[model samples]
Target: MSEALNRNYRLCEEIGRGRFGVVYRCYSLATGDSFAVKSVDKSLIADDSVDRQCLYNEAKVMQLISPNPNVVQIYDVYEDDSHLHIVIELCNNSDLFHQIANQVFSEAEAAAVLAPLMAAIAHCHRRGVAHRDVKPDNILFDEWGRLKLADFGSAECFREGEMMSGVVGTPYYVAPEVVAGREYSEKVDVWSAGVILYIMLAGIPPFYGDTAAEIFEAVLRANLRFPSRIFHSVSPAVKDLLRRMLCKDVSRRFSAEQVLRHPWMTTT
Candidate 1:
């Protein structure tokens, strides 16, 4: 519309859409570089204004973690009376979910995705930001094939040893303590990452069911298993890393920094 084009960025075509709004290919008039822009109407968001507050929190958290290439680049935030425009790095390949949905992810390929993300997660945690959500759909790859972490709407700033209580992540990846409604920390993100890695290798979520409630039940019990038929090809060290990251005990979960230096991350 006129609102978008008049903002000095030319909107090309709609590339994708999510709970927030539509994403489009946009080019900056001043720099001539192209980027992706997400446009969301203020009225079409969530109840209790949680969605709007999440939008603001996402911006604040991203601004705090700027200049990290492993994370999505948020160029600017613009708002009109009707909509909020978030200009961000465009990823032609979209998200990792579709790619993994169609094929198996070899150990190296999984590592390729996890290493930088571990680093990015480390960066977020070091800055006291818990991403809270770390699903495959939020992992994007640029045109050059560099993986970047996206979607921080569920993110929250945390202090060390602080316990946060909230059921706030994709069901399949939610940490056990979170499902149990117990106090939790940034370790929740590691559990989500562990679930992602499991899916990448097993071609299915570790905790899955016919309904969301069943899945939540499985998560509450920390029911995790590597079916021999599925994980038959996986190496022990990689499985060991998964066990550590997916630990039911939040205190035992591997931190992002520990995951980054994990042997499987460095091995072929």
Candidate 2:
């Protein structure tokens, strides 16, 4: 830990762990506010590795897109000879994956959950930032149960009219265009969000397989279906929205802003 960080905050117990770092509960010395600090060991990151680039980009991107209530906020950053420490607001409640594992949500309930996420994605896209990875595991909740989008290790910046090429997302949540190894735009986040909505409503992924390869095959096929047994009660309006979002044709997929304006999203 840097002296500056230690001087201003008292680092406490480990709260979480990730690929390159451990998250610790921390407290601000001056205001006594609670925060989470992700300490990344510099030694673990190779100089030219994508992980290293994303680690640094995560801070820059969070600084750019944060302050939206739905997105996790970054407060401060510190660097030492040994590690890079990023301090951010803490979302005390568990992630959306755990919540989904517990219960399936109705269309109205799922809409309620997805509204803020769509808003967050819209905000990111408008800022020229693409989350790239928008799975349930990255959706967290604060102590008040407000949904918060977390993790930016796979995020990157892009121009308004251009596309980004990289297969950078969880298999089930990745867009078909991405799986096809084609240049893609910010709408990839919408595809992932659409997958999340599907999972929340059906308690299962729209595409599934025994392995990542099979899952990617299913995603490439992009045959979205609401099995009658599971989606008999789900409204057609939401289904239409899902079709627009999860469409295999990247050009036909809904943008994050379009998703927010959809009838299913608006009415709920």
Candidate 1, residues 80-176, lDDT tens digits: the string is 8777888888888768888888988999988888888888899999999999999988999998988899988899998988878777998898888
Q: What lDDT would each prediction earn against the true structure? A: 0.87, 0.93
Q: What are the runs in model 2 whose C-alpha is more than 4 Å off?
A: none
Superposed Cα deviation of residue 130, candidate 1 (Å): 0.8
Model 1: residues with Cα > 4 Å off, grouped in runs: 1-5, 46-48
* Model number with the top lDDT: 2
Model 1, clash count?
0
Cα distance off (Å), candidate 1, residue 85: 1.1
Q: Per-residue CA lDDT of candidate 2, range 1-268, in tens?
A: 7999999999999999987889999999999999999999989999999988999999999999979999999999999998999999999789998989999998888998899999999999999999999999899999998989999999989998988998999999999888999998999999999999999999999999999999999999999988999999888999999999999888788888899999988897
